[model samples]
Target: MEQKSVWLDEIKFKAKPSLKEDINCDILIIGGGIAGISTALELKDEDGVVLIDKGKIGYGVTSHTTGKLTYLQGSIYDDIEKAHNFKTASRYLESQLYAIKMALDNIKKYGIKCDLEKNNSYLFAAYDVDKLDKMKKFLKKTKIKYEECDLPVNIPNINAIKVNDTFVFHPLKYITSLREIIIKSKVQIYENTRATSISFEKDYYKVTTLEGNIKAKKIIICTHYPFFVIPGLMPLRLSLEKSYALLSPYKNEKFNAINVDDEVYSVRFYKDNIIVGGFSHPLYKNINYKKEEDKLIYFYKKYFNKDIEMAWQTHDLTSHDYLPMIGRLNKNHPNLLIATAFNKWGMTNGILAGKILADLALNKQNKYADLFRLDRPISFTKVTNFITNNFMVGKTYIGTKLIKNKDFYKNVHIEMIDGKCSGIYNDENGEKHIVSNTCPHLKCSLIFNKLDKTWDCPCHGSRFDIDGNLLEGPSVFDIKLK
Candidate 1:
């Protein structure tokens, strides 16, 4: 019998109360997902490390992912070349390949019993069968070892683009092990704690949270999205794309990894069942969170009802150029770094980022640093693609704000202009004040989700507190009282 996720409720974490008193650490790692835990594990041999998660680790996008480990990231190389150059694309693929090997090595090193499987990864094709031709051209130009081969998938009427040496494993299990290692390293791990706000104070950085504050020499944002909004502008710099995954019982299907061209669908056999993942889009266009779940259930009923065991969901943040962003935040904030925007290639890239970041934190030079540079130049196509995709979010946000509600009591404030949501609070002087009503993210239209008591972004699914503080992101920044 396949064991359930380590995060199941029966599990108990007898952790001490987080750092209530102000303390300093050499590094303050935020967001205990794969990137954060992996980073902490890499830096475990180093001294003075602190890692904190708003909730338990591995519960973020990593938990919900299909966990495909391969260098073939959907239609990304085509865009990578346009955004930067062919050399960048070559470096990216090479780095991704390296990351995959690193992941396997780490699993072996820890003896993590996550159902790791080696599968042949395929970038399946649909209307854009020509995409294979494109890949061939890129292969020749970059002098990389790959082929334009038709995949042997059971699914009919679709051509496959095969990328060799891909693997899949249970992400949560891998991350949990990393977390354990980080914790055992004597590195401080805090759960259910948040870094509410951050400010640079001279040589140190002050990280304020609802519970307490921490003074650290360096901060690493593995939060997936940078919570500090305007300065980092992660939401604006990046795009949020979501995909679905279904894990059903396996009943003798022979093949490896499979992803259709145009990324309509992807499938891989995992443990007892085949993990079906893919069918992606910009976050705002298909805002129905349950669509993926529904698809999984529907697939179970129509196709493989017998072997099916469980269903899981995951989200990935894709950059415009379809690559992971790693390295330092900027020259000014040298101590601060980010490893995010994996573009669905987080399995390897996320792990690799941790190693590179650990080296960076310890003042050791990493060879891959230049390729994953934080501030790469964006081409015209990238800018256009970003603007085009975000326009829907902008429009949605603006349209929602124009709605006039008489029942919107004192607690309700709306932005007359972009229609983003704002919080209504009474001041000591009893004055009515209004704030910007939209999410600072891709400017998704905000709806007051009554149950959550927060302004939820309909576009990319970010949630903000009634006071406009960040409850969730793709937005990264909170709704501000402008």
Candidate 2:
């Protein structure tokens, strides 16, 4: 079984060159995931637009997603209504529906073959009938058509609601095809170019990358987690969640389902394989990575009774208000925009973010702009969650610093080497690999991910390979010991 995302298997693309010298552009985008690529596609006709990524396009969080394009997200409208109001929730629902249509229109216009399959989406409840009922009421209030039905999969559920106008597709295939189209336009794309910092100049912002500087009149941060904090205070408003997924060979199913229970189990299909994902927890709360992954595997085996072919995990940033932040960073810098905290529904939110962000950058008035602005009014729930989430982050940071020399796995151990805190892993050939145990972003101690054999930061979601190369980040610098 492979330890990587199934979407990344056998797909190939020629990576664009990294930025080598200082360059200037009218607009500079600092990520290459779904959000970044989508935004680039929107601005392809505009002159002097450049996009750069620390790694290749479509290989980051986008590759690890479940790739469901459905507005029937698991109780999102209910959550939004509870957090804000019905009007807000309804507007958010409208945005999602519009985003789905945008995706379909783009696919049709470009003739992109991404295995787009129209299927029914189900929201089921095994024990949480009250939550399912609440979702049903919300759907009815929003004038959405849904049916009472049983889940097609052989999972224990008491009630289920179904919507038929949803879809599942290959996220990487869609993104790579968009990348090909963007490359043929005027937008410049560079891979392996990490933006380390951004500084405000007299008339523009200067982004400092590893190899060069990017000066642009407008900047959009599409990075999953923004490296900076002061402009938006993103860390306080956002929390990270990690979920596990596994694939097993099965006949293609025409439906996808997610339960509204405390432990979310999302099931979908790709060709002849069944993909099951769930077992989510706050990034700071989950340190036993292997045990968490095992729970999902055990759950799949109990129901599907099939051998797992591949497994992977992903982290998502969730906002306190349960809405994506998709406008200017702050009033002081309208030119500095950002789109993040999708709350695990990146396939829809990311696509809509492109239109909202592009409209903001171009000084055009997008109808949904006010709905997802970064400085929107905060609710009592958002304030409470902000304090709780940050408190957890602080506790985790201090807790990791206090512990040392702990062994998470037999092959991996943390120890002090030459007076420096280092993590050591012994390979199958008995070769020892060592690197700094501290995360470069905030100096938080790293936890060894046993299943993936990588070091992950529990405070934030920064990750590194066994050799200490940066994989995902709010941290751009690698953890390799100098």
Best by lDDT: 2
User: 75-137, model 1: which lDDT tens digit per residue?
Assistant: 678778878888888888788878888998988998987778776666666667677567767
lDDT at residue 437 of model 1 (Cα atoms): 57
**Candidate 2 lDDT tens digits, 1-482:** 77889899957988999999999999999998999999999999999999999999989888999999998888788789989999999999999999999999999999999999999999999899999999898889989999998788898899998999999999999999999999999999999999999999999999999989999999999999997765337688899999999998999556888988888989999988999998999999978888899999988989889999999998999999899989898878989999999999999999999999999899999999999998988889989998999999999999888778887688988899889999999999999999899998888999898888899999889999999999999988998888
Q: Give TM-scores for every candidate, taking all chains together and pairing residue i with residue i.
A: 0.82, 0.98
Local error of candidate 2 at residue 150 (angstroms) = 1.2
Runs with alpha carbons beyond 4 Å of true place in candidate 1 = 1-16, 137-153, 161-164, 254-260, 291-314, 402-455, 464-471, 474-482
Give the clashing pairs for model 2: none
Worst 10 residues of 1 by lDDT: 1-10
lDDT score for residue 96 of model 1: 80
